[model samples]
Target: MAEKVRVGVLISGRGSNFVALEEWNRRGDRAYEIALVASNDPDARGLMAAKIFGLRIWAKSHKGMERAAFDMLMDAELRRHNVQVLALAGYMRLLSPEFIRAWEGRILNIHPSLLPAYKGLDTHRRAIEAGESFAGCSVHVVTEELDDGPVLAQAKLRIRPNETPEILAQRVLKEEHRIYPEALDTFCRTLRGEAQPTISSDLKK
Candidate 1:
Protein backbone atom coordinates (compact mmCIF):
# COMPACT_ATOMS: atom_id res chain seq x y z
CA MET A 1 0.00 0.00 0.00
CA ALA A 2 1.77 3.11 -1.26
CA GLU A 3 0.36 5.89 0.89
CA LYS A 4 -3.37 5.63 0.30
CA VAL A 5 -5.40 8.84 0.31
CA ARG A 6 -6.50 9.90 3.80
CA VAL A 7 -10.29 10.25 4.06
CA GLY A 8 -12.50 11.87 6.70
CA VAL A 9 -16.14 10.85 7.02
CA LEU A 10 -18.82 13.32 8.14
CA ILE A 11 -22.16 12.29 9.55
CA SER A 12 -25.01 13.68 11.59
CA GLY A 13 -26.84 10.59 12.75
CA ARG A 14 -26.75 6.85 12.26
CA GLY A 15 -23.79 6.28 9.96
CA SER A 16 -24.56 3.15 8.05
CA ASN A 17 -22.83 4.61 4.99
CA PHE A 18 -19.83 5.57 7.07
CA VAL A 19 -19.58 2.00 8.23
CA ALA A 20 -19.64 0.85 4.63
CA LEU A 21 -16.80 3.15 3.68
CA GLU A 22 -14.77 2.20 6.73
CA GLU A 23 -15.30 -1.51 6.15
CA TRP A 24 -14.23 -1.16 2.54
CA ASN A 25 -11.13 0.81 3.47
CA ARG A 26 -10.23 -1.77 6.09
CA ARG A 27 -10.00 -4.42 3.36
CA GLY A 28 -6.38 -3.35 2.63
CA ASP A 29 -6.84 -3.21 -1.14
CA ARG A 30 -7.94 0.35 -1.67
CA ALA A 31 -6.72 3.74 -2.86
CA TYR A 32 -7.86 5.46 0.33
CA GLU A 33 -7.84 5.04 4.11
CA ILE A 34 -10.32 6.21 6.71
CA ALA A 35 -8.50 8.61 9.00
CA LEU A 36 -11.34 10.27 10.86
CA VAL A 37 -15.04 10.08 11.61
CA ALA A 38 -16.62 13.40 12.53
CA SER A 39 -20.06 14.64 13.47
CA ASN A 40 -21.79 17.86 14.42
CA ASP A 41 -23.68 16.10 17.16
CA PRO A 42 -21.75 14.25 19.80
CA ASP A 43 -24.69 11.97 20.56
CA ALA A 44 -24.93 10.72 17.01
CA ARG A 45 -25.35 6.94 17.08
CA GLY A 46 -22.65 6.57 14.47
CA LEU A 47 -20.06 7.93 16.87
CA MET A 48 -20.58 4.95 19.13
CA ALA A 49 -20.08 2.55 16.23
CA ALA A 50 -16.91 4.34 15.19
CA LYS A 51 -15.63 3.79 18.71
CA ILE A 52 -16.10 0.07 18.22
CA PHE A 53 -13.66 0.23 15.30
CA GLY A 54 -11.23 2.28 17.40
CA LEU A 55 -11.39 4.95 14.70
CA ARG A 56 -10.53 8.53 15.56
CA ILE A 57 -13.69 10.48 16.33
CA TRP A 58 -14.38 14.22 16.53
CA ALA A 59 -17.60 15.89 17.51
CA LYS A 60 -18.95 19.33 18.42
CA SER A 61 -22.53 20.43 18.87
CA HIS A 62 -23.45 23.06 16.27
CA LYS A 63 -26.17 24.45 18.53
CA GLY A 64 -25.20 28.06 19.07
CA MET A 65 -22.49 28.62 16.50
CA GLU A 66 -23.07 30.08 13.09
CA ARG A 67 -22.89 27.65 10.22
CA ALA A 68 -19.60 29.07 8.99
CA ALA A 69 -18.07 28.84 12.43
CA PHE A 70 -19.03 25.24 12.81
CA ASP A 71 -17.83 24.44 9.33
CA MET A 72 -14.48 26.04 10.00
CA LEU A 73 -14.08 24.12 13.21
CA MET A 74 -14.68 20.85 11.39
CA ASP A 75 -12.46 22.04 8.58
CA ALA A 76 -9.59 22.69 10.97
CA GLU A 77 -9.95 19.23 12.45
CA LEU A 78 -9.87 17.62 9.01
CA ARG A 79 -6.76 19.54 8.02
CA ARG A 80 -5.12 18.65 11.27
CA HIS A 81 -5.69 15.00 10.60
CA ASN A 82 -4.23 15.36 7.08
CA VAL A 83 -7.48 14.15 5.57
CA GLN A 84 -7.25 14.36 1.79
CA VAL A 85 -10.84 13.53 0.96
CA LEU A 86 -14.18 14.04 2.73
CA ALA A 87 -17.05 11.60 2.50
CA LEU A 88 -20.31 13.05 3.77
CA ALA A 89 -22.25 10.00 4.86
CA GLY A 90 -25.41 11.29 6.52
CA TYR A 91 -24.33 14.76 7.51
CA MET A 92 -27.53 16.75 7.92
CA ARG A 93 -26.11 20.24 8.12
CA LEU A 94 -25.92 22.61 5.19
CA LEU A 95 -22.35 23.56 4.48
CA SER A 96 -21.22 27.10 4.15
CA PRO A 97 -20.26 28.26 0.65
CA GLU A 98 -16.71 28.98 1.75
CA PHE A 99 -16.26 25.47 3.01
CA ILE A 100 -17.52 24.03 -0.25
CA ARG A 101 -15.10 26.16 -2.26
CA ALA A 102 -12.25 25.35 0.07
CA TRP A 103 -12.75 21.68 -0.48
CA GLU A 104 -14.28 21.71 -3.91
CA GLY A 105 -13.88 18.45 -5.81
CA ARG A 106 -12.61 16.89 -2.63
CA ILE A 107 -15.98 16.17 -1.04
CA LEU A 108 -18.29 13.26 -1.82
CA ASN A 109 -21.89 12.57 -0.74
CA ILE A 110 -24.42 9.73 -0.87
CA HIS A 111 -27.97 10.83 -1.59
CA PRO A 112 -31.24 8.92 -1.64
CA SER A 113 -33.69 9.25 -4.51
CA LEU A 114 -31.93 9.02 -7.89
CA LEU A 115 -31.15 12.78 -7.65
CA PRO A 116 -32.48 15.60 -9.92
CA ALA A 117 -35.78 14.42 -8.47
CA TYR A 118 -36.24 14.58 -4.71
CA LYS A 119 -33.27 16.76 -3.85
CA GLY A 120 -33.92 16.92 -0.12
CA LEU A 121 -35.76 15.10 2.63
CA ASP A 122 -38.85 12.91 2.20
CA THR A 123 -37.34 11.37 -0.91
CA HIS A 124 -38.87 7.94 -0.45
CA ARG A 125 -42.36 9.29 -0.01
CA ARG A 126 -42.10 11.45 -3.09
CA ALA A 127 -40.92 8.57 -5.21
CA ILE A 128 -43.63 6.27 -3.94
CA GLU A 129 -46.36 8.82 -4.49
CA ALA A 130 -45.18 9.64 -7.98
CA GLY A 131 -45.77 6.02 -8.98
CA GLU A 132 -42.28 5.74 -10.34
CA SER A 133 -41.15 2.33 -11.40
CA PHE A 134 -37.79 2.63 -9.71
CA ALA A 135 -35.99 4.38 -6.88
CA GLY A 136 -32.27 4.61 -6.24
CA CYS A 137 -29.33 6.27 -4.55
CA SER A 138 -26.45 8.37 -5.85
CA VAL A 139 -22.90 9.16 -4.89
CA HIS A 140 -21.76 12.49 -6.18
CA VAL A 141 -19.44 15.45 -5.74
CA VAL A 142 -20.73 17.93 -3.13
CA THR A 143 -21.41 21.32 -4.64
CA GLU A 144 -22.76 24.50 -3.02
CA GLU A 145 -26.31 23.78 -3.99
CA LEU A 146 -27.94 21.01 -1.96
CA ASP A 147 -27.87 17.63 -3.68
CA ASP A 148 -27.24 19.33 -7.00
CA GLY A 149 -23.76 18.14 -7.64
CA PRO A 150 -22.45 16.15 -10.58
CA VAL A 151 -23.40 12.52 -10.04
CA LEU A 152 -20.44 10.18 -9.94
CA ALA A 153 -22.33 6.89 -9.65
CA GLN A 154 -25.74 5.45 -8.85
CA ALA A 155 -27.49 2.17 -7.88
CA LYS A 156 -31.20 1.74 -8.46
CA LEU A 157 -33.96 -0.59 -7.22
CA ARG A 158 -37.35 -1.14 -8.77
CA ILE A 159 -40.29 0.28 -6.82
CA ARG A 160 -42.45 -2.52 -5.47
CA PRO A 161 -46.21 -2.57 -5.87
CA ASN A 162 -48.05 -0.69 -3.07
CA GLU A 163 -44.77 0.08 -1.38
CA THR A 164 -44.71 2.51 1.51
CA PRO A 165 -42.06 5.21 1.90
CA GLU A 166 -40.54 3.47 4.89
CA ILE A 167 -40.06 0.25 3.00
CA LEU A 168 -38.74 2.05 -0.01
CA ALA A 169 -36.24 3.91 2.16
CA GLN A 170 -34.98 0.68 3.62
CA ARG A 171 -34.38 -0.79 0.17
CA VAL A 172 -32.75 2.34 -1.20
CA LEU A 173 -30.43 2.38 1.80
CA LYS A 174 -29.10 -1.02 0.87
CA GLU A 175 -28.13 0.25 -2.54
CA GLU A 176 -26.67 3.34 -0.89
CA HIS A 177 -24.41 1.18 1.21
CA ARG A 178 -23.50 -0.82 -1.87
CA ILE A 179 -22.39 1.98 -4.19
CA TYR A 180 -21.16 4.87 -2.03
CA PRO A 181 -17.84 3.27 -1.20
CA GLU A 182 -17.39 2.19 -4.79
CA ALA A 183 -18.10 5.67 -6.06
CA LEU A 184 -15.70 7.16 -3.56
CA ASP A 185 -13.07 4.62 -4.59
CA THR A 186 -13.39 5.40 -8.27
CA PHE A 187 -13.61 9.14 -7.73
CA CYS A 188 -10.28 9.25 -5.92
CA ARG A 189 -8.62 6.80 -8.29
CA THR A 190 -9.76 8.64 -11.41
CA LEU A 191 -8.92 12.06 -10.03
CA ARG A 192 -5.41 10.82 -9.33
CA GLY A 193 -5.13 9.82 -13.01
CA GLU A 194 -5.18 6.19 -12.08
CA ALA A 195 -8.17 5.10 -14.23
CA GLN A 196 -11.19 6.15 -16.22
CA PRO A 197 -14.77 6.10 -14.99
CA THR A 198 -16.40 2.80 -15.86
CA ILE A 199 -19.82 3.88 -17.05
CA SER A 200 -21.08 0.34 -17.49
CA SER A 201 -20.09 -0.61 -13.97
CA ASP A 202 -21.54 2.57 -12.46
CA LEU A 203 -25.08 1.90 -13.58
CA LYS A 204 -25.53 -0.94 -11.11
CA LYS A 205 -29.28 -1.30 -10.72
Candidate 2:
Protein backbone atom coordinates (compact mmCIF):
# COMPACT_ATOMS: atom_id res chain seq x y z
CA MET A 1 0.00 0.00 0.00
CA ALA A 2 1.15 3.54 -0.74
CA GLU A 3 2.05 5.54 2.32
CA LYS A 4 -0.26 8.38 3.21
CA VAL A 5 1.12 11.91 3.28
CA ARG A 6 0.58 13.95 6.42
CA VAL A 7 -1.75 16.91 5.82
CA GLY A 8 -2.37 19.72 8.27
CA VAL A 9 -5.58 21.67 7.67
CA LEU A 10 -5.98 25.34 8.62
CA ILE A 11 -9.37 26.83 9.24
CA SER A 12 -10.90 29.94 10.86
CA GLY A 13 -14.63 29.56 10.79
CA ARG A 14 -17.16 26.81 11.53
CA GLY A 15 -15.01 24.31 9.62
CA SER A 16 -17.53 22.88 7.22
CA ASN A 17 -14.81 22.34 4.68
CA PHE A 18 -12.55 20.74 7.25
CA VAL A 19 -15.28 18.31 8.04
CA ALA A 20 -15.72 17.58 4.36
CA LEU A 21 -12.02 16.89 3.87
CA GLU A 22 -11.76 14.74 6.97
CA GLU A 23 -14.78 12.74 5.91
CA TRP A 24 -13.24 12.19 2.53
CA ASN A 25 -9.98 11.05 4.11
CA ARG A 26 -11.78 8.55 6.31
CA ARG A 27 -13.88 6.96 3.56
CA GLY A 28 -11.21 4.81 2.00
CA ASP A 29 -7.50 4.11 1.45
CA ARG A 30 -6.07 7.38 0.14
CA ALA A 31 -2.84 9.24 -0.47
CA TYR A 32 -3.08 11.64 2.48
CA GLU A 33 -4.22 11.74 6.08
CA ILE A 34 -5.44 14.84 7.91
CA ALA A 35 -2.77 14.82 10.59
CA LEU A 36 -3.61 18.11 12.21
CA VAL A 37 -6.38 20.71 12.33
CA ALA A 38 -5.08 24.17 13.26
CA SER A 39 -6.99 27.40 13.61
CA ASN A 40 -6.51 31.04 14.60
CA ASP A 41 -9.81 30.93 16.43
CA PRO A 42 -9.81 28.74 19.50
CA ASP A 43 -13.58 28.73 19.49
CA ALA A 44 -13.94 27.37 15.98
CA ARG A 45 -16.60 24.65 16.02
CA GLY A 46 -14.48 22.63 13.68
CA LEU A 47 -12.04 21.97 16.49
CA MET A 48 -14.75 20.07 18.31
CA ALA A 49 -15.41 18.04 15.21
CA ALA A 50 -11.72 17.40 14.77
CA LYS A 51 -11.55 16.17 18.31
CA ILE A 52 -14.31 13.71 17.59
CA PHE A 53 -12.46 12.55 14.51
CA GLY A 54 -9.35 11.98 16.65
CA LEU A 55 -7.25 14.49 14.69
CA ARG A 56 -4.51 16.48 16.36
CA ILE A 57 -5.80 20.02 16.89
CA TRP A 58 -4.02 23.33 17.59
CA ALA A 59 -5.30 26.88 18.01
CA LYS A 60 -3.80 30.26 18.82
CA SER A 61 -5.73 33.48 18.42
CA HIS A 62 -3.98 36.01 16.16
CA LYS A 63 -5.68 39.09 17.61
CA GLY A 64 -2.55 41.02 18.56
CA MET A 65 0.18 39.16 16.73
CA GLU A 66 1.95 40.43 13.63
CA ARG A 67 1.01 38.66 10.40
CA ALA A 68 4.48 37.35 9.75
CA ALA A 69 4.91 36.39 13.36
CA PHE A 70 1.71 34.41 13.37
CA ASP A 71 2.62 32.66 10.18
CA MET A 72 5.94 31.69 11.71
CA LEU A 73 4.20 30.25 14.74
CA MET A 74 1.94 28.25 12.43
CA ASP A 75 4.96 26.98 10.57
CA ALA A 76 6.59 25.83 13.78
CA GLU A 77 3.49 24.01 14.97
CA LEU A 78 2.83 22.35 11.62
CA ARG A 79 6.41 21.18 11.51
CA ARG A 80 6.13 19.91 15.06
CA HIS A 81 3.15 17.86 14.00
CA ASN A 82 5.14 16.33 11.15
CA VAL A 83 2.86 17.78 8.54
CA GLN A 84 3.95 17.39 4.92
CA VAL A 85 1.19 19.44 3.27
CA LEU A 86 -0.94 22.33 4.47
CA ALA A 87 -4.52 22.68 3.36
CA LEU A 88 -6.36 25.96 3.81
CA ALA A 89 -9.98 25.28 4.55
CA GLY A 90 -11.45 28.70 5.18
CA TYR A 91 -8.28 29.88 6.82
CA MET A 92 -8.89 33.65 6.71
CA ARG A 93 -5.44 35.07 7.36
CA LEU A 94 -3.26 36.09 4.44
CA LEU A 95 0.08 34.37 4.89
CA SER A 96 3.29 36.32 4.73
CA PRO A 97 5.64 35.75 1.82
CA GLU A 98 8.08 34.05 4.18
CA PHE A 99 5.55 31.41 5.14
CA ILE A 100 4.48 30.95 1.53
CA ARG A 101 8.07 30.55 0.48
CA ALA A 102 8.77 28.12 3.29
CA TRP A 103 5.93 25.89 2.24
CA GLU A 104 6.44 26.58 -1.46
CA GLY A 105 4.52 24.02 -3.51
CA ARG A 106 3.39 22.11 -0.42
CA ILE A 107 0.32 24.20 0.34
CA LEU A 108 -3.16 23.97 -1.13
CA ASN A 109 -6.28 26.08 -0.66
CA ILE A 110 -9.91 25.84 -1.63
CA HIS A 111 -11.29 29.23 -2.63
CA PRO A 112 -14.95 30.02 -3.04
CA SER A 113 -14.76 31.59 -6.47
CA LEU A 114 -13.32 29.77 -9.44
CA LEU A 115 -9.89 31.25 -8.91
CA PRO A 116 -8.48 34.15 -10.91
CA ALA A 117 -12.08 35.33 -10.81
CA TYR A 118 -13.03 36.69 -7.38
CA LYS A 119 -9.77 36.61 -5.45
CA GLY A 120 -11.06 38.32 -2.34
CA LEU A 121 -14.24 37.95 -0.27
CA ASP A 122 -17.91 38.35 -1.20
CA THR A 123 -17.40 36.10 -4.17
CA HIS A 124 -21.01 35.03 -4.63
CA ARG A 125 -22.33 38.57 -4.35
CA ARG A 126 -19.73 39.85 -6.76
CA ALA A 127 -20.56 37.16 -9.30
CA ILE A 128 -24.26 37.90 -9.03
CA GLU A 129 -23.65 41.61 -9.39
CA ALA A 130 -21.61 40.96 -12.47
CA GLY A 131 -24.43 38.87 -13.94
CA GLU A 132 -22.20 35.88 -14.20
CA SER A 133 -23.83 32.77 -15.57
CA PHE A 134 -21.97 30.50 -13.18
CA ALA A 135 -20.38 30.77 -9.76
CA GLY A 136 -17.79 28.22 -8.74
CA CYS A 137 -14.92 27.10 -6.51
CA SER A 138 -11.27 26.20 -7.07
CA VAL A 139 -8.63 24.18 -5.35
CA HIS A 140 -5.27 25.77 -5.99
CA VAL A 141 -1.78 26.25 -4.68
CA VAL A 142 -1.49 28.96 -2.01
CA THR A 143 0.81 31.59 -3.41
CA GLU A 144 1.87 34.97 -1.98
CA GLU A 145 -0.78 36.80 -3.98
CA LEU A 146 -4.26 36.19 -2.66
CA ASP A 147 -6.10 33.41 -4.49
CA ASP A 148 -3.56 33.63 -7.27
CA GLY A 149 -2.20 30.15 -7.83
CA PRO A 150 -2.15 27.25 -10.23
CA VAL A 151 -5.58 25.70 -10.03
CA LEU A 152 -5.65 21.94 -9.55
CA ALA A 153 -9.40 21.44 -9.71
CA GLN A 154 -12.61 23.41 -10.12
CA ALA A 155 -16.37 22.92 -9.79
CA LYS A 156 -18.77 25.39 -11.38
CA LEU A 157 -22.39 25.78 -10.38
CA ARG A 158 -24.87 27.71 -12.49
CA ILE A 159 -25.98 30.97 -10.90
CA ARG A 160 -29.69 30.92 -10.30
CA PRO A 161 -31.89 33.90 -11.01
CA ASN A 162 -31.63 36.53 -8.25
CA GLU A 163 -29.70 34.20 -5.97
CA THR A 164 -28.68 35.59 -2.62
CA PRO A 165 -25.09 35.20 -1.59
CA GLU A 166 -26.08 32.97 1.29
CA ILE A 167 -28.07 30.65 -0.94
CA LEU A 168 -25.49 30.71 -3.65
CA ALA A 169 -22.83 29.96 -1.05
CA GLN A 170 -24.71 26.88 0.04
CA ARG A 171 -24.70 25.63 -3.53
CA VAL A 172 -21.07 26.46 -4.21
CA LEU A 173 -20.03 25.01 -0.87
CA LYS A 174 -21.32 21.58 -1.83
CA GLU A 175 -19.03 21.60 -4.80
CA GLU A 176 -16.14 22.86 -2.69
CA HIS A 177 -16.63 19.82 -0.51
CA ARG A 178 -16.70 17.59 -3.52
CA ILE A 179 -13.57 18.81 -5.29
CA TYR A 180 -11.19 19.80 -2.49
CA PRO A 181 -10.58 16.28 -1.24
CA GLU A 182 -9.97 14.89 -4.69
CA ALA A 183 -7.72 17.80 -5.58
CA LEU A 184 -5.67 17.49 -2.40
CA ASP A 185 -5.29 13.75 -2.83
CA THR A 186 -4.15 14.07 -6.41
CA PHE A 187 -1.65 16.75 -5.52
CA CYS A 188 -0.25 14.66 -2.70
CA ARG A 189 0.05 11.59 -4.88
CA THR A 190 1.76 13.57 -7.62
CA LEU A 191 4.29 14.87 -5.12
CA ARG A 192 4.99 11.27 -4.14
CA GLY A 193 5.96 10.45 -7.76
CA GLU A 194 2.64 8.85 -8.65
CA ALA A 195 1.23 9.48 -12.09
CA GLN A 196 -2.08 11.17 -11.29
CA PRO A 197 -4.20 13.65 -13.19
CA THR A 198 -3.52 16.97 -11.48
CA ILE A 199 -6.47 18.94 -12.73
CA SER A 200 -10.19 18.21 -12.87
CA SER A 201 -13.38 20.18 -13.39
CA ASP A 202 -17.03 19.60 -12.71
CA LEU A 203 -19.25 21.92 -14.68
CA LYS A 204 -22.49 21.80 -12.77
CA LYS A 205 -25.34 23.05 -14.88
Give per-model CA RMSD: 1.6, 1.0
Tens digit of per-residue lDDT, candidate 2, span 76-191: 99999899999999898888999999999899999999778998999999999999999899999988888988999999889988789999999999999999998888888897
Give the distance in Å from residue 174's predicted Cα in candidate 1 to where it truly belongs. 0.7
- The number of clashing residue pairs in each candidate reads 0, 0
Q: Best-fitting candidate, measured by TM-score?
A: 2
**Residue 185's lDDT in candidate 1:** 85
- Give lDDT for model 1: 0.87
- Model 2 regions more than 4 Å off: none
Per-model CA lDDT versus the true structure: 0.87, 0.91
Instruction: Report the Cα lDDT for residue 153, model 2.
Output: 93
Best-fitting candidate, measured by lDDT? 2
Every model's TM-score: 0.95, 0.97
Candidate 2 clashes between residue pairs 3 or more apart in a chain or in different chains: none
